[model samples]
Target chain A: MNSLDELTHELFTFFNGFSSWENSVIKTSELSVSEAHAIEILGTHGQMKMKTLAGHLGVTTGTTTVTVDRLEKKDYARRESVKEDRRIHLITLTQKGQQAFAEHHQYHSNLTEQILSVLSNEENEQLINLLKKINAEAF
Target chain B: MNSLDELTHELFTFFNGFSSWENSVIKTSELSVSEAHAIEILGTHGQMKMKTLAGHLGVTTGTTTVTVDRLEKKDYARRESVKEDRRIHLITLTQKGQQAFAEHHQYHSNLTEQILSVLSNEENEQLINLLKKINAEAF
Candidate 1:
């Protein structure tokens, strides 16, 4: 049996490596880390309410509001009020935001390819299966 | 063969789940995200200078200085001058900080156990070996 300590160390080491790679990738762009995260969520899931964005980002609505505000100011995103309920606002990425999202996603694909290159075909399938189980149930 | 796009989605979904779990865990504490990150590094690696901390965090020194300042204020860490090089200062975790590290690490172990329960013994070993390879080469 692999000790919990060994697995935990390796898990965190992997997380840290991914994090550092992400931070450096964001640094080369104009978007802040939080801003880039918001963009990713919005891009992946399409337009969503502020509350939903906050939930996805695991941040407070107030924090999401600030991030959305910055994105709007930078012309990367916009908040539109629903005609039926003016109080409810849905956030959408603008053309600029979509472009950034595509660029960022390409980088993610590149990284994924890099990771795939290091593993065997069977290992890649095993990894996907393992990650699927963990993602669906663990968290 | 798993397509790159499919693997990319699963990988990011897994990453997002882990990220959300971590943020929520941190939210229950007094430490900010950046501060908690710094403590994790200092606690794991022991004392280090400001530049080294920033490098590990993949952030700018200015940003690190601000984070270290907050840590110092909270008495979670301190900067000590080396006698041989008065200009150099190493950041060390205080007793309180060590206690916090232990607590946070326990949360991580709990999470790992939770994840382990969802997989078989063979799967667990496979996971460790796969993570080892990825951590060694993927990032």
Candidate 2:
């Protein structure tokens, strides 16, 4: 295979392995992977408007609405009208949501440590830079 | 933030971007991402038993069965009873499935090209090696 082909194939395998592990971790929760991701984003960034949250998640407002509905029903999150603009709704994680987000973050930390252990400190830095470059310029 | 924390955060964003792009590409099809993935695996590896396919996809036999059933209905794949063992089913892509697989591979190729365009040849090689190391040793 060509260099590009080889790289792509290896990347695909790596992602597959990582995602399988993620699925197992998220299976422990009542939330789907996407739902848990919404919680994580809200927890990290604090309360935000529905549009902003949807933008970060790269999902449609409709899909985000459904997700927020489920979170609200589970008491993990709730939407409140913006004080200045009652027409706008902001979504915030509840205490339970914060707890779930913390657990998920810990799971990621453990996985990160395990993966980073395979590389030297320098290699980890290089990987981070490469990922940033890809994210910034590749899309 | 610490190196580990920064690395984890970047990786999460990278994956989220990639998956959103993948979802958009797969949304044009009748198949879900998992179902399309099953087609891709079968297309790449040629015909294989259902159990083997399930193992490769890191999904349960029941889940694999549902995906394969959808593929068959869509005329993207077929399950053939092994002549040696009537109870055993092997899954293979049909002609249309092969076409869809080719399209999906091309899509990945385009995305890979865009991502790799940001890196030098040497960096690409290093990245491939790093990914391989992670896959091998990161569990």
Candidate 3:
């Protein structure tokens, strides 16, 4: 059995590597990391309330408001008030935002492809399964 | 074969889930996320120069100097001058910093243990090896 200490060390090493890789990729993009993340989330999950977007981003609503405002100014996203709730603003990505998201996503796809290239098909399946299990419990 | 889009989507979903999990864990810690990260990196890798620490933390050296200053004030870390180079300072964790690092490490270990509990011994080994391979190339 793998000791907890060993497992933790390995987990952290992988975490650090993954983060650095992501950072390097994000650095190449035109959008700031935060902006790219916001656009990615909106693109993937579709429109959400500003508060909900903040929650998903793990940022304060005020910070989310500022980011969304910037996105709006850049024509990357838009804020709309629902008929039932003027107090709540639904944030949606603009066509330009969708394009940015798609471009940014290509970076992730390329990285994932490179990472998986070394594994056989069966190994790839096993790896994905293990990640799925761990994520299910961890999340 | 997983299409690029499918692979990218899966990778991102897993990334989002992992980040959210880490954020929740860090939120419960006494130190701010950045502070905790500094201590964790120091604790993991031993003492380092401020520039190197900032590199690992993915922040500017000026930002790191400010953070190290706060950590120094809090008695979590200390800076020492080397005999050959008085201009260069090495930052090391204090006893308090080590304790916090240990405590924070427990959160990671616990999460890892929970995730690994469901996997078989062979599966665990495979997962670790796969992570190691990916990390080596990705880093």
Q: Mind giving the per-residue lDDT tens digits that candidate 3 earns over A1-139?
A: 4477777777778777767778787788667778878998898899999989998888999999889988999999999889998898899999999999888777777877887787778878887777767666646
Error of model 2, residue A15, in angstroms: 1.5
Model 2 pairs whose backbones collide: none
Tell me how each candidate scores on DockQ against the true complex.
0.83, 0.77, 0.60
Task: Kindly report the interface RMSD of candidate 1, rounded to 1 decimal.
Answer: 0.8
Grade the docking of candidate 2.
Answer: medium
Runs with alpha carbons beyond 4 Å of true place in candidate 3: B1-3
lDDT, candidate 2, A2-65, per-residue tens: 8767777887777777778888999999998779889989999999999999998888899999
The predictions' CA RMSDs to the true structure, in order, are 2.0, 1.8, 2.0
Q: Rate the local accuracy (lDDT) of all candidates.
A: 0.92, 0.87, 0.83
Residue A75, model 2, lDDT: 96
lDDT of model 2, residue A53:
94
Write down the lDDT that model 2 would get: 0.87
Candidate 3 global Cα RMSD:
2.0
lDDT of 3 by residue, B29-77 (tens): 6677788889989998999999899998999999999899989999999
Which portion of correct inter-chain contacts appears in model 2? 0.78
